[model samples]
Target: MNNEILPHEEVINDTLNHFSGKFENIFHQDNYDHYRSAIHDTLDLVGTFLHRNDKPFSGIEAKTMKKMVQHIDLNQKLSSYEEVLKEVDEIYVQHATAFHLPQYVAHLNCPIVIPALAGEILVSAINSSQDTYDQSAGGTFMERKLIDWTAERLGYTTESDGVFTAGGSQSNLMGLVMMRDVFSQKNLNHNIKQDGLPPEASRFRIFISDKAHFSNSKNASIMGLGEKSIVKVPTDNEFRMDITMLQKYMKREILLGNIPIGIIATAGTTDFGNVDPLEDIANIAAQHNIWMHVDAAYGCALLLSAKYRHLLNGIEKADSVTIDYHKSFFQPISSSAFIVKNKRELRILKHHADYLNPAEMDEEEIPAQINKSIIQSTRRFDALKLWFTLRMMGQEQLAEYTDRIIDLTKDVAEMITENQEFELLTHTDLSVLVFRYLRSDIEDLNALNLHVKMKLFYSGEILVASTKVDGQFYLKFTFLNPITTTEDVHQILNTIKKHGEDFGTTN
Candidate 1:
């Protein structure tokens, strides 16, 4: 080759050296000080943002935000940490929705506990993959302990076992998976894991309340069953699953030569926060030899509540249960679990990977969390968040927060009922209120309510949600923050009233 190095070769060498130097930021022991400094700076920024944020939203329009984001050039050279942080603050933190605010009574989102946030820091820094014991070591056992604790709270026996999931949707999917496989194996002698769904899968049906989460229909579709596989039982006046209607549906479906595979009961429905008749549904499921799954994603907080725990009375009878710690438990996003009454049910999801978790490892008594999981391979250490919350705050304190929210909902419902301009739809069993602004002079009530919601969102003073009930639009308030007082509700209602009046006067 040439005695002198070529220009392109020199350029390549320079680039290689630069890339190698970047390894200093790879979070090794040698970069501990650098890591600590960066984390401290980031935390300080976040703390300041939280303290300064006054509104739930910045009221920035979608087109405006999109244009702001589009102006940034991702292909540009790397900038200093300070420059990057400044841009992030302007684009994200400034306009971010403040779920922690008392005015942000819109969705199922909750203001997370401090301990869980601390746990999240450790989880991201350590980056323990909860797939196999060798990958996570002590984290594996720690997660299992939390699962056991949750199972106990759910009144599940020692034989019960579960795995952490992303959220309610994934947890609900796992429950349906178990229901599908167990029914297939027992009735059709088909191993869904090995041979795929049986021919009779089309005939299989799941029963859910009309007000149940949309995940039931989605999960059925995901499992090779059509959307028609889900039969929505009508709800009563209180928006709870009517037990008689459910029984009638089951009999009718069977009469039509369709097999009732499972019942997915909602504990704390999304809009009304009303729980289905769990005990009655459990009895029906047992009588029919069908699986019973409780999607307690929202109301699982009742597991710890001393006063409202009875609302989840027959949850113990469920073959599987889904719990979202992120919702009522006040944990961060993507913290949820799917538990089964029998540990043996998890065997259906087991598989062997020679380089990862081989079959021989099981014989050697190695604990691998992948054995119980279906969709996930490399999973986050989300269980630690719940573990920290329980250890630092204790279950009693958490339950008190739950009780406060439930009590608060009742107070707000009464307030809405007293307001002549407002119409209360249903008295919730949990912390959700559904109501609508009413005006006899307004010919289009739906259009008026919709306009009010949009105006409030654009005004940025308050953040509330809206949903359609029986083809009529209604405003929804989901109280997850214990700090949100009756005064906050009063202010929120006044804002809505003001908007409604503005619409009436303008239109």
Candidate 2:
């Protein structure tokens, strides 16, 4: 050693050797008494540091990260395990999203309940994939049963099946792919999954609401149906899709000899939380004999709410529906389900390679789940969180959680309405409110509101998301945390008012 400059491999090897060993070979406490104090202090310090928020609202911005990591490696020869743990923890864990905090009411999916988090740990430990029975035996069985349970909730027949996906975007993509497989009958007759896209892929057109999620257009583009192929149906004042307009457009397109592929009805839109009149839309879909899909990612959790379940009326008639556990069901992110009214729609994505999910003539149980699913393989058993949450809290508790956030949204709407400086975006349909900061005689404050949002984000006191509606910037609060109270809304309003006054005076 040249007076002690350590190589990279030597250091890494030393660290690994200290951390792992054979269980029986490592249990000699008397031999390791010298290292005992280090472990206790390290564990205690880690737990203690977790309680501290590196920045306000418990979210770590870049500035906060740089401030936390002020020192550079000029050359400290040897550091204790506790010191190294502290440094690594500060760098890595400090910049995490603060879902546990009461103020985190920003995006579609934020916090998850503790039960689901516990399930996350358990599922991670087991690490099951949803590809086959042997790959995730218990997970596979549970997911199938979960599908049946979800089907029952949706009022579908016993033949219905669903799978948990990464998120709403993937679920919607899968739905569109299924429709692609279905409408191309010549390809279906010849078996497309084994074959490929039919030659007539260019003619297929997807009809979606004007207020559909961006993911719809994205999915269309991904599935080889160009974004231009999605015909936008005008929405009514309530933001619900105009079924009459949709029918009119379909008729015009049909007369023009356009191939109608599938109809997508949004159950909950991003802007105003508007759900299309599914009952009316369903009738139009049935009359036209088009495949109907419902993107109910944010609003499908209404199924759990006794009072609000009526909002999703006729959802059962949909050919497929996308439900996000991460958004409304209060599970962690990457929890969503694409449920098909008919189980046969799932067969479109099945692929069989030799070592993967090979098919045999005499094989019982159909030989493969790969055939009846959209995803390729190696799915993180994410549905276990839903299953665990359901079993632990039950539907009633979940409903209560949803109801609490809804009540909070109501409080925010009321506060925004009474405030002279603030304008209410829309009435609270679900647990989301879109509002803007404007005094009397507001013309166009889109750019101003955009700046205000950026300023607020940089300040890191209160958290809210900015959305553009009708070409105007509006601040939105999507309350997912049950613990978020009326007081929290009051805090956000106070901040907005203060910012408005300061901004006006400065301007």
Candidate 3:
């Protein structure tokens, strides 16, 4: 087969030029054939490369990788679209993490479904900005509908409202920002948004579980609350937050004249996947008139799992909540939202911009999404991915997939516990297990575990994550991929043992 372009390529180029420039034709359907051909060819190459290299990941040395990247110059131009696609295939496609692979039991990444994949293509093609109604049209309504649906599932009040955000981190920032402003207004008659934080801002505090995601402290810092403002409540043996300890800390802070502004209850912590006791935490926050926020980024999948929904029993009581569909709902990254129990609370983040959402539009009886969200002036249409997935496959099917992964986690934990060389750190709370290898005659087990993890990572045969627990390194298995089977688990276990034994023998 000839590799050159068609003999009629010049005619096609002339016709394309007659319409407009390349950028202008992209938005018009008249040039869809040209666009479709390029997309089809690119995706075909990606699929073929992935099929050939089924391993989850591979690592290249820093020096070698840097040299390879330096070889590509921005000023250099490729001859044809085929050459561009081939270059991309070699540089990125072969090395990108294959979350679909069963051996890739690493982070909270999920294997995306077909419907969402299709939605992703449509989203990129249309390039809708969901920040305002005029910019996104139906996309604005679609996002709000998904948020309302999610609120209903969590059993929140009918007055609840939410906005799609980049991820859990930004959502957490929004929740805390609201808490800070609202607390200032209610207690000190201060508007932080207008007059800025009070001199006593340093005295304001937010209570959170010891196992909560690091975003709490980071958001506190970003909001000018300072890192010292975060008070981590102790966790029980199961890693769930201790309700009594939280109450004690809150009371002590109050006695010291520090106003407790918010309480963050984590539903599925990053490393352990353990959930805080939401009911108890909610009651404590109510007693103190504090804003209650639940970080359910990892555990939100339980809301869809009919059999496991009770795991997040008191999540609805939260004044605000953060849920990452990307993490738990098996959607692609950048799919998440921050929800509030009362729609009026969203006013704290609202601003009127004449160029975007003007006051005149509100006076003329118009609605725009920019009035709600705290971030993103030009946001991508991500809600379409979830909407299409739910409409095509149904929530029930997704729930079934979630339950399967949870069950797989439990089985894998048992296998690790039964092994003599392996030490299971904590019980399966959601779908994460942090464990390390501990051979009877081995010394410096931490170093051994680290070496084993890096060895497997460099080998590119399988991929998994590692974390530190109580100052010791342990491997982590986050079973978000439903395709990861018992056999895959056994193979990974065998690989870990082999690596550990070899390291011990060599070192």
Indicate which candidate wins on lDDT: 1
lDDT of 2 by residue, 369-486 (tens): 4555565577888889988999999999998887887777787788789986888867757877788888554355775677667667767666678787777788888787887788
How high is the CA lDDT of each candidate model?
Answer: 0.91, 0.76, 0.87
lDDT of 1 by residue, 96-126 (tens): 9999999998999999999999999999999
In candidate 3, how many Å is residue 66 off?
2.1
Q: Estimated TM-score per prediction?
A: 0.95, 0.84, 0.94
Alpha-carbon error at 142 in model 1, in Å? Answer: 0.7
True-vs-predicted CA distance for residue 287, candidate 2, Å: 0.8
Question: How high a TM-score does candidate 3 get?
Answer: 0.94
Q: Sort every candidate by lDDT, greatest first.
A: 1, 3, 2
Give the best candidate by TM-score: 1
Candidate 2's displacement at residue 389, Å, is 1.2
**Per-residue lDDT of model 3, residues 1-507, tens digit only:** 877765698878877677676464355777777788888898898678767776887676668766767899979888778998888877777777788899888888888888988899989988999877778888988998999999999998779999899999999999999889989898899988899989989999999988899988998998887999999988988888898888889889989999798899999998898888889888888888889999999999999988999888888889999999999888887799999999998888888898888766752355677777887789989999999999999999999998998999999999998988899989866899999988777788889999999998988888889998789899999889888899989999999999988986766
Write down the lDDT that model 2 would get.
0.76
